[model samples]
Target: MASNIIHFEKDIEFSKKVVLNTSKKFPDPKFIFSETSWKLDQFQNLKTKLNFVKHKLNDFILEEWHEHTSKMNPSGLVVNHVRKHIHPDFLTQAWCKFYEIMCNSSLVSQKSLLTGNMCSVHLCEAPGAFISALNHFMALNHQSIKFDWLAMTLNPYHESNGHPDTVSDDRLIFSTIDKWEFGPDYTGDIFQPRYHEHLYETISKKFDNGASLVTADGSIDCSDDPGEQENIVMSLHNYEMMVALNIIQNGGSFVLKMFTIFECNTICRIYLLCCLFQSVEIQKPATSKSGNSEVYVVCKGYMGRSLATPYIQMFFKSKNHDNALLPLSQIPNNFIDELYNCSSYFCDLQIKTIEKNIITWNNKNESYKEINEIQRIICQEYVNRYKLKPIRWDQDVISSSNWSRARNNKRKINISYSEKLRRRDLCLQEEAVLLYQEIVNFSNSKTNECHEILWGRCDQVSLNISNVKYCLGKPVIQVRSSKFCNDSLLQYRIKIINKFPCIDSLSNSESRILYFKTKLNYSKNGINICDLTDTYAKNRNNNVILQYSCLFNILETLQQKSEDFLLIGYPLYTQIAVACFFVIASMFDTFAIIKPDRNFGHAFAFFGFKNLENWLNILSEVLKYILPRNDSYTRSKLALVSWLPIQQLVKQRSHLDIVLLNNLCIAYEVEPILLSFIQS
Candidate 1:
């Protein structure tokens, strides 16, 4: 026991000596690529020379390290335990990290910055775990802060962004779309110089005094090139720092995610941060998986934007493609030595963990009892220390995106007549005028060469081949959501199918039947009109863009000169719905919006003799209006679609058709109408 104690003390002393040597050798830091070719070669040489040393394991046994951390880290274990019980949005590893930061650091609690208004900007923040955690933290600690936040991330639903590049899960974005800035192109890609400037302007406008807290958790999926992870993300890191520095207030705090900071860019970024902030510390939170080289650089007491300008101009702004920020010869020797020592220390720690995991993996008799005990004790301590309370996820609190779950519960709330009127009224005439102007502009604009011929038509369209009949053109091409499977929607479907027999089977080679049986998820009690309208208003552009993309894809497949489209359960007030009407009107001879279910939106049918030649010629030109552009926010096509007058759409109108559309619109209360309050 005495010998063991002595060894532990010796280990502590050795760690201290390593730190002391690093500090003594390099009192100030420098910018150099300490982790690339030079470091890899050095690591290989040391491994070969010290082959007998058990701690110097072959390669970094990352998988084993993951296993080790999962078993050992109490916070990680607690996260897994509570993940399912709590809302998915609030129970992420990232959530725990923010909570831990709040508990440990003065990022949020700094009294000087906690004035009347507190603002935070979350960059590359998707699935909004950080925001949720911060909300939870504020509720528990400082309820009077009047916190306002804005988040940006790669638009998950963006047609351009694919997997490994964007966060595809869009629950958070869908719920709180208004709070997010998708940049000019609606693709929140900060790596682009344009987005950076746009975001800077947006932050400046929103927060005059600058953000009190700015957190950037931006990272590229470098799984394919793990060895050069730091190098791969150097540009992104620089951009994140630039944005944070430019927008952060004098005493604001910035929390940035970094990994194995050995690259020249990484070193330069860190050195700059150290210079710009009063205190900067590297944190490897317990919530973060130990296998990966993930660390958060917590910077507090920013020395203001003026101090950051020189570094920004010298290193960040300059587009010199050199590997090092400055030549190694020019950098101070002490700084280089410090960088090397720090890098080596982290590398050693990683190697030792890997070696320990390897030993554990080999030893079949290794007991995890100690680990289990530690997890329990630490988890309790963590909860107590952080003062974490179970979050009550209410509608007004954290608007969860689990609409399906809400629908299942059948929860209803009483809303006032005025509120109902507000939710239901969509000014069509106003929207149409704007839409018409946009259409005119689009028609005049030059067509994109790429969309000239939509290459994939058959593959893109969901052709229904199972039930075929020669009646109109082909089998009904049915598009549906899982939400429509309920009995209520099923009845509506039956009524529609019975009324329009040709909808199931189309025999005329010149005609086609497109049926959309969509029933979007609503709350358990029923549709929350307020929630629905608010969401629609926020995502109007995106919805238009999405609809346009889909319509463009389908239009390519419309080989038939005349195509009939049936859109069910769509509120005609939406721009996408209006766009559908416009496209059908442009191609077909007749169009009608009919009521299917009063509870749901409306149904639309467009059928007539048509020729695709003219439509095909103008397809790209017409579609350009819906495409997300630099001027989407200012000259929004959605605004036009939302308030476009329904009357001006048709050249010839029948009383019966008007009554049908009016009834349909009134049934859903989706179109502009004044409600007269009569005594019940």
Candidate 2:
């Protein structure tokens, strides 16, 4: 009664009779089962017989006798050897077998026979090793053919047993509801009979006719009792078969993963598949571990829907009755009864004994010790292959005491305030040059002909003023003192207003002369004005003309503030320069502010102009004047304000609408009058 002794005197005779009887029934002999034996002499002889018969039949099952022997002595070296070469997880072996069957069968060739493309569907597929296996097989064997695939499984976001069912590999890509290339929608819970209509509709929309290959690796939670486990697996198998039947096209193939063929429901499913397919064979590839009961039902050459409709209807109608069984009387074919008998005999003689041996092995303490040793060995090997050296944080440190002292002394010598100022200025100049180059390069890459005009103007400005340094030597504005209160501030403003001629009369030279005289008189306390005028006439070449109308508006506004403070000798020209820089910065800043809001459509359009060469050239001129100040905070603020608009605009447009508006304001010579509009 030992579990390892599967074929006793009476059972060996019965196994021989069942194999001979089943082999005789197949005319072409497509259906065949390799026999199992317990005795060493009988097992060796059976292997020799299988090799001889394998060449004759296209499909043949290989019985697993080695695992039964290892099960009797659970601490044997054979178990350790097998574990070392392959992953202990059974799914790895199952996927390997699935790949082998697909390649060896005509499924690959037949898939593209009707249509130019091959399409497949996977049901209840998650943690995706099956798909990974298929991908590997196609990559190695048929590299030229392209195929489409769709997959449906439980949503990983949904909670199951306090955790989501998620893939271990993060890199898998396929068709699903959230991430898909082929289908508009995905089918949910194909096991439910009510979900069948949705499933069919989804497949019809995704695949033109139907999928050429359908694979179901679906299973449910099993109880400790073998009978209860068998019942749950059988119920799940029914749902899996229903899906496979509905989706597969004519001449398509199906591979169903199932436990050993012991239960009556498993026999019924096999019989149904036999009636629907041209050939049906059960196979357990070498990659599948010998200890497990899992086997694949590889059904090939699907009969068309017209031929399968009646049988399918009867199967569905049986759901309402007790036991939900498809009556044996309804099957017109004689092969059903014969297949059932063969499957029953094979299970009783081979699988049941193996199952019992597995149970006996599971109860042993040595088996647990052997498994732990195998895992430890695997971990050690993995570490040897992939181990990396630890990073050394102090690698760059100077190890010699003398070298460290020398470096510290050198750093201290270079840390003076004046030296720091010089280095800081040098850094700022380098950054400004780099910024200018980046702007020019971006303009060259993205701008059009209209943008080039603005760039040309920028080039002109840089070339014309390259040698001219606008070093206004601290020209001052006098604030009116309460003690020396005079209406002279009002009188000076009126005098400037009268001298500032109409827009048409004020030529560039005339404007320059008027601004210089006003600045010269203000610095001299509005008294010794003739002396300053004479001095200005002597050094007229040193006075640079401020041409921008916005500059005049800023000067006038500053004059007003100076009068209110009653403070004199403020630097008028330097303030005007800073104000002009602010104007340019504000325009770009406004564009950045409006870019993300949908309601600011006009502002958004203005923000997108691509021709930034004019803007870049103008900014470069202003930065050249500001960089000498060596103020990091101001430089950083200016850089950020200037770069934001350019970055946003570079993606789309190439025209400078804002620049043209500023230019038109200057051309009209009405900057002071239009100061509100410019500021807005």
Candidate 3:
């Protein structure tokens, strides 16, 4: 009985905390007594006390809440179990997850900081993207943002920031609100309580410190008032034409829910924000349950003249609410990387940075790749000298041309070896096609197979490899920095990433292992595959030794290849997200920069980790410093790391040059030796 009483007291206390955070203390006591407010306190003093109680409520819920849940709804676990299936739009899903975790009280306490310093407003409006965020928050953690007079409120969701795209504007709930007599329902302005207290007080004050909403004529352009650069202010939705015309100092953010009404004015407002803000990205919150019209937010940085940040002289409220950016300039250059290198953009300080530096990109400049004959020669010499043999699982590599000829030769009745050779030669001249449809099916079929036909001028063949299914969706994007690919191997890697978000940040090491293990499992017979990194490193310093000992007597493969890489005709920077790296002819022989053991060491690391593991990490750092804010170098770095597959390298174990050889030896467990001379 005593425990029960204590539990009751705890519940009451938690209720108070929720009340305080969700609502604001109205300065006008008269407004609180109005019919709009009841049961909940107009001022949140009691609610503040309750939140302290609820801090402990978290522990209590974890320990005892489940018991209450089990009793309240027996078979509760199975009854509500369902998978949330989201299709495509991986970036939108990412943005939603960031908000869901950040905004929820259960997941993150108010006192702690969040990643990316991203911020959001529960736009006082209803049924829009803001509400969608709220619903997502509730669905993810089961904590609804219980509101003011929720039960008694009529047409409460009229101005919400969500709406199904298919629904015509005529059927909108607001359609009726604007035209008909809706009884004091529309009178509940979120800013009403504060308006009675202070007019000059910034919107931040009336923010309910939760989410605030405003309804303005959509005809006017929205902007923060530049005159009042005192404190940071943001509008979740921008039907308010005066938002941008009346903004606070740095670190202000605004999400404008707009139609394509004022194209010129909209462009001007956005352009100004881009100039003042650091990093800016246009996003559509696809995860929003409301699926409302497009939301374009213009976020700005805090504007306190700071020597630390001379660029904007911006100052943001620190975690402690003090003038935090005063010493921001004192931050070391090295530490600067950490601050800028984050995922979130809608937050406080970080948002300001992103807003100011936002770049509008129309095209990506492909990395310059001039054929280096010296590097090619060096790579060849290194490989030849190391003598590392590629895994010989297949009888021969299906060169770009031979795939069709082999198929045609098989079709001819008992064709002679010479005739087969002729067909194989002809296959090289044929146009590339996914011919598998003639003998196979495409999407929606039960199996994973490649079935298109690329009929060439000369040859025809079927790529009926069994491991195709596993290869079908390897990379959500292509791996290497290549232009185009017709190879089945290339196609598989490209499709894989395009399908799976989990593989987005995978490193070369991880992707390689995944490919090999998957292929090995699906292969007709289980084969003992060789470790590429180890093999290459083992014979790195001695190319000839590796080739002669580990490989069959296939002579002059490298020596005969053109010294000028320009002649080889390989594409540049093959889709880095897809696998398509080819050694050009121009690179000097024995010019391997990364050793196998170290560069492709684990074959199971994420892209981030792989870059950091190899010397490539240093190179990436350089690119980060050099590339513009919107450049695809970061993506390139990621793709480069994902391109190296464990099996691909292990199967093609080749020798490394001196630089790579030394690194490989050290990586593959070589001991350092000191040379000392003793005079006799």
lDDT of 3 by residue, 1-680 (tens): 74465345333312211000111111221211122111212112322332233233232222233333232221122111111222111113223423322232232222112221222332223323233333344333432333211100112222111111111111112322331211121222322222211221333443323122222212111212211111112221211323322322234333443322111223223333344444333433212211112333423232221211222111111122122211322223332232222111212222222222222111112211111222233233322332212222221112223222111111213433334345445431130122222112321231222211111110111111221111111111212211121122223333322332211111343455445345224233322222334333344333323322222111122223232111111111121111211121012222112212212332211010111122233223322222112213112211012223322321222211221222222222211110000110
Ranking by TM-score: 1, 2, 3
Query: At residue 510, what lDDT does model 3 achieve?
Result: 47
Cα RMSDs of all predictions? 19.1, 30.0, 29.3
Better of 1 and 2 by lDDT: 1
Output the TM-score of candidate 3: 0.20
- Least lDDT summed over 10 consecutive residues: which range in candidate 2? 593-602
Give TM-scores for every candidate, taking all chains together and pairing residue i with residue i: 0.58, 0.40, 0.20
Tell me how far the alpha carbon of residue 245 in candidate 2 is from the true structure, in angstroms, after superposition. 1.4
The better-scoring model by TM-score among 2 and 3 is 2
Write model 2 residue lDDT over 249-281, tens digit each, in one string.
Answer: 888888888865444455556766776787677
The superposed Cα distance between candidate 2 and the true structure at residue 99, in angstroms, equals 1.4
Q: Pick the candidate with the highest TM-score.
A: 1
